[model samples]
Target: MTFRLSVERLVRIFPAQGGAAEPTRAVDGVDFVATAGEITALVGPSGCGKSTLLAMIAGLEPCDSGAVRAGAVTVTALSAEKSALWRRAHVGFLFQDAGLVDRMRVIDNVMLPMIYRNAKPRDRRAAAIAALERLGLGNMIERRVDGLSGGERRRVGFARILADPRPLLICDEPSAGLDADNTEEIRKLLQIARADGACIILATHDPELVTVADKVLPMRRGQLVAPDLALRAGAQQAAAAS
Candidate 1:
């Protein structure tokens, strides 16, 4: 079944850290609709809640209040086991660090998700190889993930995302630390995924990557805000940190 991701008044709060008195609203009443076959980019600096929001949508994190729906399923209502099953069936999440098993061979890492989904061993292997080859990583499939460069590791992670081709693809800073060439490579892969009719939501600070998105949601202090305001706040935060 085709799916559209809908988040309604989604909220998540965390106890204050360090010297803070009030709890932090990690995601504050975030409501948005991301359609199938379109890319939605969440643009913000660190700690703006993009990652938390994505996690909630994917059922990886619990919501403090509100609802998350992916087509007919109420994501917010799922139990831990059901959430895992739901994610395996519909969501492909790419985290900032690529999240590979460092000591494993690249192909094995790519096949991990398929194993959980109970795909046949031979079929999963073939799908993994095809995905790796599509990402220009066919030659690296036998190499240990720990031995790969940063760009190569990220590519392997992307390969894993492609292996099963779930309907919803959520990525967190898929291009965090890479050279120009590697960044462009990721952009192309995102384009390819969109063409395959996946609902893609990505959290990123990279303006270049943002350009590829069909819609850009600028976030600040855990809320969707005006683009200029978000940009200014990000700038101010950067200055204060420096």
Candidate 2:
């Protein structure tokens, strides 16, 4: 099934640590639509609320005020239990940290999402193997995740996305901190997902990946802005801090 994402007036505020500091408006009244069969790239400098916004859309973080709609479902309004269930059914998240179980075998880690969605064990195994093989990890399927390098772990995480093929794929810096080859590998994987008609939304600073996007949403200070304006805002903030 195909699903489009609609984000409306999204807001997330973090209170000041002490009485002295001002509150941080992580994502302030952001709105956009990410259509299925295309990729939406959120481009911005670090600490510009890209990750926070993705978290809210994924229902991994609560919104201060706003609504997230995926197809006909009100994502932000679902109960905690229901939200989790809904995510397992519809979302494929590729976290920046390469969220994987270090204690499990590589193949098992890739199979986790399929398990949550109750895929047949035999089919899940096949899909996991195919995904791993595609990412050049077929030989290490039985190896423990903790033994893998950072790049390997990240690739394993991508393999999970390949195995599940969820309608809504939310990726946070999917190609961050990788060599050219690995980054290219990730780009190919993302392209494959787009071709398969997943509504792909990713937070990235990778220009190569940006070139593949169907739409680019540039952000600054938690709000969408023109590309040039976002660059100017980031430069201005840096000069002020200096």
Candidate 3:
């Protein structure tokens, strides 16, 4: 199977307090592959480095060892400028916070990525509107982002990522501030993205998010374990006997 994203023996370390001790290993030799059209959920307790790994994958942070490959490109050796270009063209990031420009209109916030990429203004507006429609936020397009509720703000963020149309989407705690209804809506949006051939990596502490994942990676003390494998195998055995 072809992987849209792969991390091979990746390691990331953060400087210790006072800058005199050994750096702390935030991600300890992690390896994983996200196949195209699949959702991979990274779940862990707070402070366990799930976000750290996601940032590395997004090229927002550098790794201390090993390689990160997005499709055919190796990100580890790319210059900062090249990495930024790669991210602009191939990656969409959704932060734990809505990360909207509060002063901007919802539609404008959703169009920001395309604008940064220098898309034609008319084309960008149309695409942003379409994305907002897809997220069921078409009616909120003209409203200021600061005026929207948490769920609405999150939808705007999702619309932004959808408008970007990147093949790789990395989201940190997408369902963080959502209610049950909003969370389900976001999950459906993620499923749609996966079906459209985007590889999605979502970092969250929510078990609800794990239920929809193709693979669930649990992190503890900066190490990941594949808990979903055992769970699925047991389910398969039970089904065989039934």
Candidate 4:
């Protein structure tokens, strides 16, 4: 299988801000591969550097050492402008916040990224609407983003990323602030994305987020730890019982 994203001994360090100690290693020689059409969950406690690792893969932050490859492209060697372009073309990022424009309508927000790519206006709008429909938000196209509920806003963000049609999707705390029903909806959406050949890397603390994951990597103290088989078996049994 072709790997959609690969991290080889990736390392990132943050310099001390206000006369603190030496540079801290946020990510320390972690390695993983995300294959196309699969969901990889990164789960751990807070301050485990999950978000930092995702940002480095997204080219939003620089790595201190090692390499990140999205398909055949080397992210570490790309210039800032080239990295931005590469991300725009091949990566989609969903943060904890929806990050929508309050003044824009739901569909418009979804179409904005396509606009930056110079896609045809009519085609962009059509694609946005289709994406929203896939997310079960078809009827809310004309509504202002500010008026939507938390779940609805998240669906809109999911639609926006889907409309971008990127191969690699990175989600940070996608289940944050979502109730059970909304969480399931997001989970279903992610499953659909995986079916459509997108490689997903999800960084989240929620145990519910791991239910559908193909592989789970637990991060702790800047290292990627293996998932506990006993815990996983217990979780599977509980899920079956439920």
Candidate 5:
């Protein structure tokens, strides 16, 4: 099933820490709609609130204001107690840090999400093996994680996304630290997922991946930056560097 994610004037502010008077506004009046079959790339510098916005969209954090509508479900309003169940129902998240369990085998890590949702052992095992194979880690499924590189570990982390049957795919820095070949594979995987009618919203700084985005939402200091201006500026810089 296809899913549409709508964010309307979303706002989340953090209280000042270490005695500063001004509270940090992590997400400020953000608004955008991510629909099925398209990849929306949130492009920006490291400190920008792109990750924060994604957290709200994934229902991993609370927004002080606004609403997140995924299909018929309102994401932002879900209580903390139900966050896991809600996420399991509608979202598949690939954490920025490649959130895989270091001590577990690749197959075990991939099946963890389904286990959290109480999926039957037989079913989750099959799904986990399938996800591993699709991401080119089929042989590594039984191998100890100590044998994998950082990029390979990240691929194992992403395998979790495929095991869970969710329509909206959220990835943060999906290609970070990957080799050129692995990065290309990640891009191809994103395209394949999009073709299968999943709505994808990812935060990325890779120019090659940016070129593939159907829409680029540039951001700075908790606000949306104008796309045309950013693109023109990038073009001028590229021209100057060449």
Candidate 6:
């Protein structure tokens, strides 16, 4: 099916942690459409609401207002119980921190999502093994996560998302802190995901990587700058320089 993830007037507010009077308006009534089989890159500097927008879309963070319509499901509007179920069955998220349990074995960590979703115990082991193998982490499956290097652990995080890919992939900087080769690996994995009709909304600062995006939305200080306006502005700069 050709799926589309749509966000309308998404907003998020964070209270001051240090007893400050004003709250932080992390996301300010942002809106956009992300289609299946293509990557929609949220290109911006740090603290520009990219992560905040994604968190609201993924239902991890509460939004003061907005509607998220991904196919038939109303993402941002789900109840707590339904929200967990919705994320497990339809959203394959790669959190910025790679949200892995430090005490678990690498394979077990990769399999945790399925375990939470109540998959057949007998089938999960084999599936986890396959996901690890596909990510070139087959030999390290038995290792504890704490024992692994940063890069190795990051790959394990990737394996977790691919263990059971959903229709939509909400990846937050899936390639951060990687060498050139591993970044390329992430790029290829994204291509494979898109080929299988998964909708990807990636938040990234890498311009070279953003080139693969079907639509690039620039954000700053919690507002989105439309791609059309951004393009025309770029062209004006080029013409003036010439």
Instruction: Name the better of 2 and 4 by TM-score.
Output: 2
Q: Which ten residues in a row have the lowest lDDT in candidate 5?
A: 228-237
Deviating ranges (above 4 Å) for candidate 2: 18-20, 234-242
RMSD of 3: 5.9
Global lDDT of model 3: 0.86
Give the residue spans of candidate 6 off by over 4 A: 17-21, 227-242
What TM-score fits each model?
A: 0.92, 0.94, 0.86, 0.86, 0.89, 0.88
lDDT of 1 by residue, 156-177 (tens): 8988998999999999888877
- For model 6, residues 24-92, the per-residue Cα lDDT tens digits are 888988889988898999977688899888888888888898888888888888898888888888888
lDDT of 1 at 41: 97
Backbone clash tally (model 3): 0
Model 2 alpha-carbon miss at residue 233, Å: 3.0
How good is model 2 by TM-score? 0.94
Residue range 77-177, candidate 5, lDDT tens digits: 88886766888877888988788777888888899888888899999999999888888898899986767888888898788897775788999988889
Stretches > 4 Å off in candidate 5: 19-21, 144-147, 231-242
Which structure is stronger by TM-score: 3 or 6?
A: 6
The candidate maximizing TM-score is: 2
Model 3 agreement with the true structure over 1-242: per-residue lDDT tens digits: 45478899989888887866777788998998988899999887677788889888988899899889987899887999999999999889997787899999999999999998999999999999998998788888999999898878888898899887788999889887788877887889899889898899999877777788998888766787667754665477689989
Predictions in order: lDDT: 0.91, 0.91, 0.86, 0.87, 0.86, 0.84
Model 1, position 113, has a per-residue lDDT of 97
What pairs collide in candidate 3? none
Q: Between 1 and 5, whose lDDT is larger? A: 1
- Give the distance in Å from residue 238's predicted Cα in candidate 1 to where it truly belongs: 8.3
Candidate 6 residue 142 Cα shift, in angstroms, is 1.0
Steric clash count of candidate 1? 0
Off by over 4 Å in 3: 1-3, 18-22, 228-242
